[model samples]
Target: MFTTFRGGSSGAWRVISMSPVTGETLPAVPSLSVTHAAAIALPLLPSSNAWRLAGVASHVRYVERNEKVALVAVQAGLGRPEASHAALIPIRKNAAWWDLTQNERRRIFEDKSRHIADSLKYLPAIARQLYHCRDLGEPFDFLTWFEFAPEHAAAFEELVAQLRGTEEWSYVEREADLRLVRERV
Candidate 1:
């Protein structure tokens, strides 16, 4: 199993290096509902790209039951990345949080806290990959990945602080932000 986010897991990040990694794709089942998508562990063919790492989620009941966020290339001139220094943050919301109505959650998420707006300020500089891990039986309900150049490191730190300080974070029961670096293969 992979390590937990921030520093919750015993596997705290000390040094980082990425050579080549091999793992199962675990193709999501076509019949699986978005709410149940993550737990589909049924194995599928492995990806050809040895450098690629894959994990999967979504937001909203309607959207989650249907499509996910579209995949797009990292916009150029966004960050001054000298090398691929990355961070993987896995987060899980408390069960009691889900018991609330959708409108109730939205009020706190947007009106009370600006989770999306705060992060948007970073833009193309700090590239991100968001994975919903809830349905997968994983410890976390969401796994968010980030990569940035050394120059924008401070921006990333500020963005993180802005998020964790929000009222929305009160629902977060578990979280870990692990740092990493990619080595040339």
Candidate 2:
């Protein structure tokens, strides 16, 4: 069983131990939200690619709740240019995004929603930072849909780098696959 300790403003962390079943008190591992669980587990899996992609999708969805940035999406691709293109969309809006077809939207949702749902486990904490992650229903892409307060970009960047750099780094390519979208709402 999992025991969660509320850390007040710091949120809750879980303490996991098998000893509970054996009527003993063993040291528990640091409690991790579902996102972190997936992040840490992704790289260790035999199918790292699939897991990493799902991890990225999960991370993206976690960060999408920011109110200042409207939407963000990241996609892995066959070439550096493809990654580049995916990265560039949030920096500048594409007319195509606003013109997406229903099929395209459905494809994006089907592919990305599970990660988003997993990400939602941390929504309360993420919401405290004024951000949320989502999938734009576009293929195997992970989307971060959020908004940033004025002058918060630098801080946001730092926070993102630090968060993504943790055990989840493998799930998200810091330099390539994480996309940011910021807009004043």
Candidate 3:
């Protein structure tokens, strides 16, 4: 299924805050809503809408069979009742990153950066979903959604900080961190 995230005045998620980590920032919006469909017609967004992004929940990439098994063993599902705090971080990497062959990228992602190993410790606590939009010609290459209990917010921060400090992040050209809270019905 394709997932679409809308940032505007309406959504089940209230925007806590949004900040630019690098490059241009997305226009501010009061809330965010997510929807899933077999196919998404994105141009339908109202003219007044601040922004919208869509991507597919594709298979896990950059991991070996053992790593994939390990991830599935420990990674938790999204929307757990007690996990309300969330963040939608959209990132666009520079051409240099895209230029690299898949193998080269994988080496940097894990062997050099240790992205997966470092993140495993925080799993089951911080649920996350990664969406790929580059194929759709979206502004961002990837949209990462993360969820956790309010108390685990600090750990989430640490994860983000650690990832950003990696050599892989040097290829990122644009990134925006949008913090959110699940709106009570």
lDDT of 3 by residue, 1-185 (tens): 99999888888999999999999999999989898999864644576468889988999999999999989999999989889999999999999999999999999999999999999999999999999999998999999999999999999999999999999999999999999999974
Give Cα-based local distance difference scores for all models: 0.52, 0.28, 0.93
lDDT of 2 by residue, 101-168 (tens): 75554344334433333333333223221111223222222223222332444554454455444433
Question: Per-residue alpha-carbon lDDT of model 1 for 68-147, expressed as tens digits?
Answer: 23213323331234635666656778877788888788777766786554555576788775676566566557667777
Candidate 1: C-alpha lDDT: 0.52
RMSD (CA, Å), each prediction: 11.0, 18.3, 1.2
Candidate 1: lDDT of 164?
82
Candidate 2 achieves a global lDDT of 0.28
Query: Best-fitting candidate, measured by TM-score?
Result: 3
Q: For candidate 3, what's the RMSD?
A: 1.2
Q: In model 3, how large is the Cα lDDT of residue 80?
A: 95
Q: What TM-score would every model get versus the actual structure?
A: 0.60, 0.24, 0.96
* Candidate topping lDDT: 3
Instruction: Tell me the lDDT of model 2 at 56.
Output: 31
